[model samples]
Target chain A: MSAPARSTGVWTAAAGSAAAEPRETASAPPRRRSARRRRRWTGLAFAALPLAVYAVVVLAPLVQSIQYSFFKWDGVSAATWVGFDNYVTFVTDPILRSTFGHVLVLICFFALLPIVLGLFSAALLTRAKQPGMAVYRWIFFLPQVMTTVVIALVFKRIYAPDGPLNQALRAIGLDSLARTWLGDFTWALPALGLIGTWVTFGFCMVLFISGTSAIAPELYEAARMDGAGPFREFFAVTLPGLRGQLAVALTLTMTAALRTFDLVWITTHGGPGTSTLTPAVALYKAAFQNPQVGLAAAIGVVMAVLCLVVALVITRVSERD
Target chain B: MATTVAVVAGLALTMSACAPGGGGGSESSAQPSSISTDIASAGTVTLKMTDFWGSAEGKWIDQAIADFQKKYPNVTIDRTSEDWGQLNSTLNLQLQDDAGPDIASANNGWQSLGTLAKGGLVVNLDSYAKAYGWDSKVPTTIIRQNKFTTDLKTMGSGSWFATPMARTSLIGLYYNADKLKKLGIEPPKTLDELEVDAAKAKTAGEIPFQYGSLDGSTSALLGVQAVLADKNKLNDYVYDVPTVKASDVGMKEAVETVKKWADAGYFPKDFAGIDYQTAVANFVKGQGVFRWEYTGSLGLSTEQQKHFGYVQLPQSGGKTVGVGAAPGAMVISAKSKHPEVAAAFLDYLMSPAAGQTAVDLGLVPALSPDVKVPETSLSLTGESAAAKTLDSDDGYVPYFDWSSPTMLDTLGQNLQLVFAGKMDSGKFTAAVDADRDAFLAGQA
Candidate 1:
């Protein structure tokens, strides 16, 4: 920091000397102020489309959902006033409460493992000069590219009790390990989590890789000159440099974990005694199928809060000096 | 349309403080005034019909549409077919508006009929029932299927709100006769004999029962219902007859008996892993001796139907009690522009031509049996067999899950646990009873 300040003082001195030689410094201040004002206006103009879209699509629905949380409505007939009853249901109902537990379970697969695997891979890639890197990227990113429902369907067949998974287990004489993977009470939720892992890890890896590229080569060389080993270089340079990427990955992946409905719906339907049930699936059924819009809205409000809180924490930590 | 959606959404927001279905700002002005009783209507009206029938089952509907259009060319029929879940959810919300379908086969529960009736989203057909002499024309038992109290809490009691054109579904044991004969086994004569047959068929390397519980274990419920032929208190349990407990001793016995079957390996290996379509396909190819499914739809070629025999899953007392009686019912939306024309078109659905179509397609006629069934192109053996079982001493019991909206989810979740060996019979029945008790408490 002292070296940078000293260099900046020298540069300012050079700039002062240059400015002293017939420069229009008074006009420049006003012109720079006008330019700054123009830039701010341009930024606002660019933000208008997304702002309007967010207002109409996201903001209105979110506000309505929060409002709906206070009612007792079945989507038809009349909605009745039942303050906090829907929220109380989520807190009290065993099934609904357990759905929140499933979200925590999914976080391990969706966010935690993806972050570690992504950081590890990005670190390794930064070490080597490799050819045919795009092929590796495509192979790794294929799961993220495919539709979740289609991926879920393929995995359904693979995890089916009598499917190829069991066949392979039998062929290798590990028959006991090959029960219906998604149907077992103990294994169902984890099996679903692993699919979440497969889907998200690739995306995180790509994100971290791009972030690693933006990291300067000078840092690694400087650490090497200081006699730091490969492992130390990763911790002292790679990790610290990749903080913003880590924050982005964690935020996006945490949202994915919290809002996981489609895969669970397509594959399990929260079956085998609600072992694989998630809040999103429960909220959807409550809203659309049972028409318990009030309860669904309460759940939605909680979900929105979770997303906002995650985003806030991520941005806060990243922005911390 | 967006404006209409926004208006209703706003209305919903403001009316949350009010009592259900009433005394809010807007009245249900779309209610038809004095529906026509005439069997004929020559008005220039297009009636939109909503049902959950696919192409195969929809053939009957298409035939009815073609015939109705020929007879009343001035009336056009626009049809929309949705899957059951989508149809139920959409119609439940949309029925309150004038933009909903003119005619629909309503889901027969508190969700569809109860709310729709209480909210005045459907036309009350009592006056029309009288004018058409439907009281005598349709069977007392069958027509009563549409009866619902004004509050919709009670069923089988109040004004007629809907009418049926055909019986929807019946759960039965459809068996492969050739396979049965090869094993020298008649379709089980009793519940005990059914168990013995299942054991024997399993030993003989044939799947005893074709079953799949993935999409709610409803087929397993059919197996449970087959063992409990005591239909005396079923109505009390299902229709929310007050002071009724769903934990029937006979039902408990049925649950244990099914558990024992699972224990004894009577179910197909990986039966829990498969789905309804795969189970049906396996049965059609003679992979299983008995498949518990709807009696009306064999969906087989004449050659395939010949190899099979349909029976009311071996009665306990020589009295065959089945699940699902009234099938689904067709009702005119209160919001319909031409309620009279829609009502006339509904009458046409029970016509002799439609009845013939029902018979030919091996479908159950919801037309009061006063109308003669037409001879069909396929052999009538399966339909006759189904009809014989249906036309027995005891009446059919409504499905247990159809009592409440969330009952299916409860039954599906807990009962699948029973099949998975995670929960036993007592626990399964208790869980269901608790669910039912909670539902009743909520309603109260």
Candidate 2:
């Protein structure tokens, strides 16, 4: 509160001085701001603690992971430096290579589908001023609040051989089409991805809703007045206004997709023989499950680099006016 | 600004006090000479133990702990459980920081023990074992399973790193007895017979075989076992041979067998993504005639027990060889503060009472001349039957998954690719050969 008061006083004083400067130009005192400079540095140092802690806790370990990538250690033994062997192995290893492909597939479900469906839902919600809009928002966000373990278990049951999905298919006289949804190689990745889409789209929708609410309603009204239809209005007004929120959503969702381990571990443990194996799952198996810590660290570094590059690219694109 | 600095410094100190590693130096010095003795003297020693088994099974462990405390009123046991997924990641961090519980359950495998042993983080139990008579009773086979060479010293050979709480075979076929009866099919005794039974079940409007490969390794293990059985060469393939060659007659035969099974539509198309629990649920719901699962699956609740029958998996060509890793064993960590206490706990668990308790919970006791397990109990009966089969059959072989350190994932995944028709039989054999070669080279 004191800081705000001081800032307002400073602003008022600067304005007054600026107005009076021309009349008494030669008589203006030189502004020796050493004390103010000291204050600013002190304030900055106080502000830097959280960031410093974050860097130490998160960024330091991340950088160490990159360093560890070039070594071979089972976490308990002496580390052996092997140059780019780990990276080479990751790129060339058939299982890891296939796992990377699976991650790409998940990106479609976790990143692309969620954003598209979220935008669509957000658009519809914007036009509908209903009495139970809050309730709908809560319902959509329910999955987000529930633990991934619960979600995976519930979804596993829903996709079971005799579960509702197959039952429904049988009822519709589509017995031939009824197969174990999560168990089939062809359906496993897509089925898991669909769950990812369902769990995440609501978060994206909420982001869009908040972002759209901030945009002036007059712009949408003017677009309609100018003969722009709903679709055109969305593209011209809503989409552009949601660029920042879209960037955030995409970054978060994409990170979630790339780092996906929990739901897969809980539901299928990356099974039916590696059909659902992602980089994170592979990293875990290599590190903790198999004690190939060095290889796991290497995989982790690669993943971090990929995430960083993607994030930077998205941020640059989103920020481009 | 100076006041602000002072305030910040105060906050920093307060936060530092809350940090996890802050108390390490002082706590290390202040800890009691013996954790168990300290508990006894204090009239209540709260020892924390963490495990992967959830609340459902944890309740049994809790009951055991309660019984332990009742016998020794001074010792209070506080038990906590975490999911295996979280535990795997957290264990190393917790161990490194000395924040892990005094006692923890660990899988008696190289992957779990090797790193910790190498790091000199666990307690050595040789002295404790000798003193407690654990050296005599616990079988050499059980001891060998947990042994590891760490820093030129074998940390877990006769020494303990973790206690064997329960034993379960990794490979078995669980069937729905009611469904089998209705379909008028006996449990298959060979690969050909199994195929016929599966076909019959499918024709009778039931899923024949319920196996999930989504984890890739489970599918590969099943496929590998089937192939090994067919060749009547399961043991020779895994341990006796120095190197596995793709062109080797037995190896090629196994790969072909797996491919043939996959092509026959005996396995569900979506079997790859289903988890172990779901696979069991499918068996329970009569969705499948047989489920390839761990022997421990028989221990599932009454609801799960309703439709299932347990049988040893059919061998290739009726050779009747059993294969799987030796059951999980207990080892003592070298760094444990109370190695004697840990050893005592292990000895107690191996006693007739505790062994029976484990058997009652659907775990096989490691010691032979097993205590009389109640036939009515779901946990005891099936495992008892399997144990009886193993005793009678000379062809029982340990699981191939446990043969090589890295083969678990590699073989499992490759087998999946083969089953999915992504890899031909030749390529699948070649891949496994290469993997085995690489693993052997690394071991050397």
Candidate 3:
């Protein structure tokens, strides 16, 4: 920060000194200023379309959603101003409060677990060119490409009591271990979390692998010369090198975790007794099914704030170097 | 960027709250005096109809539309159909617009019907009802289900906002004939007899009930409510009677009975993991002795229908009451171009001919449940018989989900907790009561 500030200060001082030198530049400054003005107009013209589109599609709705959080609306009716009552309800309501805990648990699965496994796999797979590496890459990245709905449906069946998961447990003579994965209250959230891990670990792995490729090979060579094993070598070079990628992956996965709706909706619908409910599912039910559009807007605002905080923290921490 | 967003939001929020359907206020846009019931006055009229019956459930509606079209050649019906949840979720937005449907098939609950009615997006149907003599023709029980107060605070005694289009849903018990016969059990005549038979089935190494609770066990709760709920008492709760509590109408007893059945291992193993469709499919494949479902053998062949017997869960008092409603009820949108033609179409829906068409399509007719039709399948006969009995007795309790906007989610989630032994019936009752009280308080 200090280096950049000092450099900017120097540049400004240089520019000021140049401007102050009035030896021959009476008409020259105006020409340069006009040229700069014309360039600025061109830049504005180029940006006008996207700016308009973004304002209409994103900004207007965002403003409306914030406005909606302050009222009591049944979508079609005259909205009643309730001030911060919806936000208060979101905080005090037990069912709504429980959803935040579910998202936190999901973040462990969707973000942390994936990053660990992703880094592990990237270390192993990207260390050397192995036969069938392309096939492995394809297999790992498969979940990232499939639609969340389809993935959820497939996982729903797989986690069924008689699905292949339980059947496999039974086949291994672990009959007592077999239970309905998605239906059990103790297991439902974790079962959903495992699906999150399955879908995101591959993307994280691909991200880390790409990040590793950008690292200087000399760092690895030096670590090897120092008699460092694979574990030490990874810590010494690969780990530090992938910080930016880790931040990117963390931001994306954490937000995905926070905004999880369709997967939970298609699978459990926050069911077997609200064991798997998330904020997004609650928002949808409030807005669509319960017709509490105001409460839904409040949930949306809170979720957006949470996601923004997570992203900002990750970005700031990653940029600390 | 942040300052700009704050300014925009502050300016908008100060100007107006975002009333989702925009600024008509909560009064009926089309007054009773302005609405004409003269179908002949509107010549070459095209009425856009939006409905939620696009699947096999739509056959009866399609037949009704055809019959109505034949009666009025001058009116052309332009229809759009989608799934039930999809349609209801978007119906408010559609109805608020000028080019929205003339008539829309709406769900019975507060979220769809009550909300739309309160917003004045749909026309008040009292004028049309009197014009078409619906009070005398449509059964009071069915009509009561569609009525909501002009304020939309309570239902069952108010001006009509929607009318059932010949079809309604009924909850009842379905048994496998061969399985019952093999177990040496006659059709259970009472709840005790049913429980005894279930015990026998359990001892005989057969799944007594083909139960799937992934749907929050609401269907099973409906079946339980059929056995347990007192029609009048349940009415007090569902119709927003202020003094009544949820536990007053045997709700806890119903929950206890379901929990007892769960403890007895009467339901299929891992039943919570199975969905309704899969459980129905399993029942058809002879996996369970009995199944609780709505009044249709949807996937059954005629032979299969004959082998399966449909009956209401037997009540101790020899009265039939169940979780049922006019699921395909239609209302005229305030934005409709042809209000009278729409009213006529709705009136035609309550006609005996339309009821006959509903029966022919294996749908339970709401208006005239006793309309005679050739009984090619025994299950249809049983459904009609059950519907007729309920109608005569005024025995239909609105599916309790209509009690509160969030009641569906509350019942669904908490019922699973009760079943899973994570929560008791008392807590479940409290959760439900909280939702109801909150909604009722909002009304006040």
Candidate 4:
């Protein structure tokens, strides 16, 4: 087949053809073929170490967990093959089933809230000619750097009935609003979700800020020259430019929300009933606390699949742009 | 791709090999006959032990270890101590490998002790018990608490799997004397009087009980001993007695009493949000009239203990019933290279000297006639509480959580729901019964 006369540099379709030529030319020249073969072997040799480590560390345990998911093992005793019994419990059992709902609510705080706030702040920070922008960026990224346990513990105190949050509310004559934030059944899940929002929104903002800076300045100038206000310019230029960053933010935040354990574990432990119970906490309890290793493995497999699907969906949706 | 597949397959096989194999069941012949109470003959043996007792509460065990080392200078003891949560989470996995501690402090339940015993990771201590005269030194009930069936399915019977390193008495009602005096209330003699006092304290704008439900605090379960009519029934329920339901053991009454307290605003406001530590801290700061606690008292300073008085809650029937549990049972590992030395170490752990150290450090040792308590020791009040329960006709009940692996979670979560008014006492009992039923069904 004849190639196109014009090519789009190294990433063009011609590059694929060029890479394939070395394999396609079987008897073209012995020296060239041997050189090509040597190059291929050297690349493989270089890749072998990391590949082996990944296989042992990641792939091996993943396969073992999947295998363990099908059996009833108490970690100490002999495992009995229970097929999908453990997996079935996740759907059939109300307590386990409710964890999925809790995670969905958390995604609103951990993923959606962060994304919206991140975009708004990124846009504002980028447009403003404010001094100490680096300082502002650092402030926004503080929560991402702080230890999760310290954050959880600090937030636990802040949400206490007589804590500063309640004290401030009471001081403002909102006495009726002051209640056990983490203890109330109706409020515990949301209370934890808000903590998630606080901890994650910073990371999202920093991600979007970098993404916004990377956008071509001429695009924003073109939108502004078209008689567009800041809002219109943002919608026209900034939002479209953030498609890849938004996808990354969504995938990271969504997975983080889904697998939240330490925060809930430290604060409520899915208490005041199983109100704040996340899938990760449930998996942990099953694995270690209850010694239901097989069930925990099943939950692990399910969570991995869910996170993978979410990341793939975000990637596919972003690629459409 | 073929190489990747081969690598993946090879890694998978390696992991499978690392996984602990089946057939952990104990055979009669597997019990080594060379067991001795003396380790001096072992020739400079280093016995490794793991325990959950960190510095604060580890005083007794630390003393015991030091004393043992002095006694058997040839036997150098290596100890790894972590907090309860950290130690328990990793203990079983550690014991599964040969490199695990020669002896580890295992939690006294089917999930921890029973699982370890059943898996044959921990040795049966019946032979050691006989050699060490643990029967005479430790009370029968305390000894039975660590006993388990050969199958390790049932607790409180059959072979001795472990012995108490240190014992925690039935959770006692600890009251602030100054607060009680300020409210013009006398120390309660019965559950009714306790309720009346609590109501009075509430009316006086003081927290009657500084309880927190966060982290699944068992204050309510412990406090329920006041009204618990039959200790053996609750004990049976915890030991996986299939015919007995949680309802039959006055669990509803327990839940209802907690509900009464919650409705009365006796517990700290937003008690569900407050953790056990904060509640105890608040109690120490004079925030509440009473604090139902067990090992928490061990952490109290002398100044705090001056105003604090502990009592085994008395029933209206003139008999006191309470729940008591050991912090953990010290068990020799089946994989230990020096089983006899580990046995001797365990024997030393429950000795009179160790018991004195436990008392001095504000902990209750296992009931021993030989273990004398100093009169000036502030632990006398707590010791008397345990003594009262030990002497009472109803005796002491085991912790309700010990009944099933998930019982603690089920009970703790539902108890919070009951206090939050999201669930009633009936539903609470049913939830626990359901958990028990499920565990029992699985066992069958």
TM-score for each model: 0.88, 0.72, 0.92, 0.89
Every candidate's CA RMSD: 8.3, 9.4, 6.4, 6.5
Model 4: DockQ against the native?
A: 0.43
Give the C-alpha miss distance for residue A168 in model 4, angstroms: 1.7
Error of 1 at A16 (Å): 37
lDDT tens readout by residue for model 3, B1-444 = 999889867876674634444464546734657556667657888989998775456777777788788877888888888777888888888887788899999888787888888878888888888888888876676778899877677888889888876666888888898889999999887789889999999999999999888857577776887688777878878888878887888788888988899889999889888877778899999999888787763467767877887777657788888777776668988888678899999888878788788777666766685587556676777777777777777788888888898898898889888888888988888888888998989987
Question: Candidate 1, residues A7-96: lDDT per residue as tens digits?
Answer: 233334333432437444565666488887798899999999999986776556655676677787766666778877889999899999
Clashes of each: 2, 46, 0, 2
lDDT of 2 by residue, B131-208 (tens): 555556554434544555433233224345444443445466677777889999987765667778988987888878
Using DockQ as the yardstick, the better of models 2 and 4 is: 4
**Cα lDDT of model 2 overall?**
0.64
User: What is the alpha-carbon interface RMSD for each candidate?
Assistant: 3.8, 7.7, 2.0, 3.0
Clash pairs, model 4 backbone: B170-B323, B238-B403
- Could you give the candidate ranking by TM-score, starting with the highest? 3, 4, 1, 2
Best by lDDT: 3
- Candidate 1: give the clashing pairs: B166-B366, B168-B327
Task: Tell how far residue B310 is off in model 1, in angstroms.
Answer: 1.8
- What is the alpha-carbon RMSD of candidate 2 to the true structure? 9.4
Ten-residue region with minimum lDDT total, candidate 2 chain B: B20-29
Q: Summing lDDT over every window of 10 consecutive residues in candidate 1 chain A, give the lowest-scoring window.
A: A1-10
Report the C-alpha lDDT of model 4 over A1-321, residue by residue, as the tens digit.
000101111123222432435347456776687887898899999999999986776666777787787777778777777778989998789999999999999999999998999899988889977999999888878989998899999999899988999999999999999998988889889989999898889899998999888999999888888899988998888999988778777877887887888899888888878988988889888988887888888888788777767766777787784
